[model samples]
Target: MEKDKIIKYGSLTLVAIFILSTLSLLFLNSNPSVNPNNSVLQGYVIGYAKISSYDKVVKVQNPTKELEKLLEDLSKNGTIVRSFNFENELVIELKDEKDVYRLNKLFNEYNSSIFADAIIDFENLTFFDDSGKQLSIPNQRKKQKITPLFDIAEPFKIKADAIVGEVSSKEPVVYLLSISLLENEKIQIALKPKNITLISYAISLKIPWDSRSYIYDLSSKLNQSNITNKVNLANYLFFNSTPSNTSLSQLASSNIPFISKITKSTISLNNIQTKKDEINNLLSLYNINVIFPDSSIEIENLDTKNINFIEGLVSNYSNLNISIQKENLVEVEFYQESEYGSTKYVLDEDKLKVRFKTALNPNDIKNISVQAEVVGNKIKDYKIQQEQ
Candidate 1:
């Protein structure tokens, strides 16, 4: 009896150990913690190019081989570069006047680009100061004594810093020269009229200050000048601004006016496009097929539980059909049917068509599952014949 009791206890202990081990393995597989580097943000650019007027001409002098090399590197790295005449000065165009501020902020972080002997002739530009003063062409150049700003060691480093916390406010200032120049002569002289004033000065210094105040001041000045509802210096900065926290992938997605309003889907789509192009270039690098159907599929009545499943199916099969029923459960149909005489034949095309009564909210998604069927070309032909 004693020996039997010991043996029974041993057996129970072994069973418990086995069960615990199995549970541990399952938990680890389901809730795997991805490393930060391997996370989806790996290959994204944290900063984006700002849109600017095309009036500025960049000229480079008897370019040293080093300057040429730098230009080549900037171009390859996706920096916007436009040549002005035969001069070696390469004009860096920004998206908006606010972007001029961002460019200045970037300058504080990296000062090497400032030594290029570039002159920003805003002679044709008209702007206002913080005191509602009319800032016109051939305005006096004011030199402000400001602290020096540090340069970022690498682009990724700046991105990492932004992800960790808010950027600092104290930054350097630059000498700003306000002037009015002809738009036509802007390209000829390499000067453009940017809708900005104090903000332009702040940017030239590489300060990270928000342009809202500067923009407001400019608007007040422009309003006095009878410019209504105009996207002048102040309003443009307010509307087309992006947050400093924008990710690299988000920056590369669209040429939208503001970076702050960028969505995850847009970023994901851009990433998908890039990945697809890469796979096409090196087909042997990946095992999965990247081809997707040309037509759009609709899904309806998807709740949290089955939305994941539908997405997985679409991701795996490249085609799917979806529909929502009574706003409750999501009904997912994988196969398409066609009528033939007295019977209907099912097609093996791994495409899904989906229609949704309403748009799915991004936050409501829960668990996802996908079911796939492998069919050959011959199977597709047979199904077509049966339906016919």
Candidate 2:
């Protein structure tokens, strides 16, 4: 009987061992086993979506083989792990992060490596995830989030001091200013006239002893809370002193107005007209003859916003006689050292001309001339010249 009991217990222990082994095997299978192929999903990137404008939902005739080969070549040392279709775009992934810049360059340089007839906007492409959500090229999709160095979200942060001067042998209080980017590839600049006020329009209001006389143009540029980087400034050349033109002078003259703080970022400048209606309304006042210097800047991308402010003045008090001069203004900037810092520009189209008309009268003429002078409340060691 004792021998039988020992044998029975040994048998029971063997059964228990078998059950434990079976359970272990099942657990291993249920849990995720390490797979070598899964590493491809780790640091992947989605290619920019290229879409058709006329037919937004038009699918590519042959997407997989031709497009796939081009993307693989663009990713440098990376490989195309997987791809799928989302709407009309071919969503693709690259296994390496180092290929981000390479892909961008390739997308721009060669729209299609194989198919010459393929038209693609490689910069802006759309793709969707498993959840049917939109997935754009990472980091670069939100262009606004990425601000180049010294770019202000609000342009008004730059101290915009007024350089009140006269045109070359021209009359009326002319605002002569020149703006340039100065090797900074992040910021944009513009100039638009706001209005003029007559403290004593002997010929034109004399640049008062108070440095605050330049406040009108300053406030117009740097007075917005959240400035949309769009400076739709029309020909700041006005012929009359109406509400828009006259009110600027009388608006804020005592001190330099404060504009809200701004953050910097880049944006597009297509289909934007600087001076549309404002120019038309003023056109009714006079036959405008404008001379735009044949100078243009070629931009790489639409990363910087375009802004414009007028660069002239208003005077109903007298026939003006003012002598103006020109400087090496192929590039210029009216930068003010405000509390924040100096404003930067990627490019500035800052050429200006000032002219006003009145019946010629010798006594009515005011003998005053101006040079490019930077005067404002924010400026130090400078004062507006008082009339003698």
Estimate TM-scores for all models.
0.19, 0.15
Best by TM-score: 1
lDDT of 1 by residue, 1-388 (tens): 1210111010000000000000010100111354433432211110111112222212222445665575566557655444332223334432232333444344444333322112222112222333434433122221111111122221211111111111122321222112221112222121113322332321121112223233223323322433331222122111111212221111111122211121111001112332444433432343322332222222233344544544454356342222222222222233355322222334454543321221334333221222122132111321110000
Which candidate number would show the highest lDDT if scored against the true structure? 1
Q: Which stretches of candidate 1 lie over 4 Å from their true place?
A: 1-115, 127-249, 256-388
Q: Poorest 10 consecutive residues of model 1 by lDDT?
A: 12-21
Shift in Å, residue 232, candidate 2: 18
Tens digits of per-residue lDDT for model 2, 121-194: 22222333334344443343322111001111111111111111111111222111112111211212322222
Cα error, candidate 1, residue 42 (Å)? 50
User: lDDT per prediction?
Assistant: 0.25, 0.23
Query: For all candidates, what are the clash counts?
Result: 52, 22
